[model samples]
Target: MNLLLIAALIITSIAVLAYIGSMVLQSWLYSVPADKMPLRSFVTALLAGGFLTLWCWIDTKNPGRYDTLFSFSSYDTEDFDVVDAVKKVGEEEKTIRYTRRSVGTKMVYMNDQNQPFRKADAEGAIFALIVTEKDKPVRFITKLDKNGNFPPGEIQYREEGGKRYIDDTMIGRVNRPGTLKVIYVLLLNFGHFLIWTLSLWLVMNYALGHAISIACCLWLVITLLIMPVLFTKTRKQEKVITPQVSFPSVNDPNLSEPEPKDEEKKGTRQFQDSNGNGIAILWIGSAISNS
Candidate 1:
């Protein structure tokens, strides 16, 4: 079962990667103009978004199947209660108690010395056969689930005295590594972010055709309006047009104003003869006379 599950996961991962790779290749080959690229990229991102959504859904549906292992913790304690009972055989007597804790599909029990003994379910009902180690090193007889859950049914074990035994499995075990759990959580969050951003892009693309172009224009205008306010140093410095006034110095030998040129005289005469306002001519005459 573990092999089959691992194979399925490997196949799924490969298929997803292959599909994403094909889309990326297509995107590179069919590169479009900036105006149209957002939609294309959005489409590619949508595929990833869908995959993420499905992945999250699967993880949620199966509870601890993908992200973690299933065990007694998987079930709510409120649903089941543990009871203690004593049993006496024809020649001996022993006390047994059902445990609330479980490791994978096996039930955990405490011996008279408080040593833990695990029992695997043989079939549909619980069995008396138990596995325990009192004076030897712990040995695992069954593999843990990828998420760290225990397998169901019977487990084969060998005693310290070289005696072999088969016991019924009772509870599931979960042995998922911390690193894998962290990676899965991070991937889930990243996928959600990607999906959200790309989904917005897709909606904008369809609802507002040429959304990219419009966004660019808005961005340009906003930058132009905001830059000067944000960075006062970047504000355009206005040129100061200072009027030059010349005054004759008291110590100067030549104090006479320069005479008007022929073009200025002609412009003044023309301005006077045209029956128009002579304000322009007066200004020109004054400037020429001053020069």
Candidate 2:
């Protein structure tokens, strides 16, 4: 019903669509085998999830909620400059100039042509933006999050001249301390980069714990040592089970042959039984015995 809500829903739907499309493409492009299904499916799902998250971000103007795209990109100079670089309408020959000014002991403002840039052509201009602080700059700056949200600050931008003086503000946000927190806040909305760092750290910590945990580490070491013993035992059993027909006697019952008296004597006095064609027998008897 609401415009913003509708926009959000649309964006979410598009994201889902993109994700499914990517999966279909992946399957069709590569003839993945069944054994590798889990790995391939995981990759496809992750990509789809990322797209869906990006869709939500575009719609909601918030990328923090989705882990998929949380670390996708980062807050670069472009993101920082978008709001600060406000251009004056109908000033092609004259380049718009802006200089930061301290309005009072606790208030500071940017002056455009030696005046506070308040009466912007809200309708005719592409955008009008101003930064406002709830507290003094020194105190507010300390409290500002890297994501560019001050404790309570306002960005007054005119999308169209005479539209409205309504300001965009982020209110009651807690101050994030230190450079790390500030950087995190700024990149908080950057879907991929922020998430990657967080995920990597979490995974590393988990892996380290597994490697260092007393019980688990001991179990791993024991298992590694035991594996070679088990393997050797298995090989020995296999060798023993395999039939060994070493030095089999010529007269053995398992050896098939015609009548012994009918056998022919070779030049070396060895008897040859023609009927013992397929028998794997070893003749250990002396040639003179039959003679």
Candidate achieving the largest lDDT: 1
Candidate 1 lDDT over residue span 144-184, tens digit each? 35433356654543223433332333322212224555556
- Models 1 onward score TM values of 0.25, 0.19
Q: Where is the poorest 10-residue window by lDDT in model 2?
A: 74-83
lDDT score for residue 117 of model 2: 35
- lDDT (C-alpha) at residue 125 in model 2: 30
On the 0 to 100 scale, the lDDT of residue 221 in model 2 is: 38
User: Pick by TM-score: which candidate is best?
Assistant: 1
Which runs of model 1 end up more than 4 angstroms from their true locations?
1-37, 66-95, 101-108, 111-113, 118-291
Candidate 1 lowest-lDDT run of ten: 70-79
lDDT of 2 by residue, 126-227 (tens): 133432344322111122244323344554433232322323332112222244433544443343333333322232122333223422432243234532
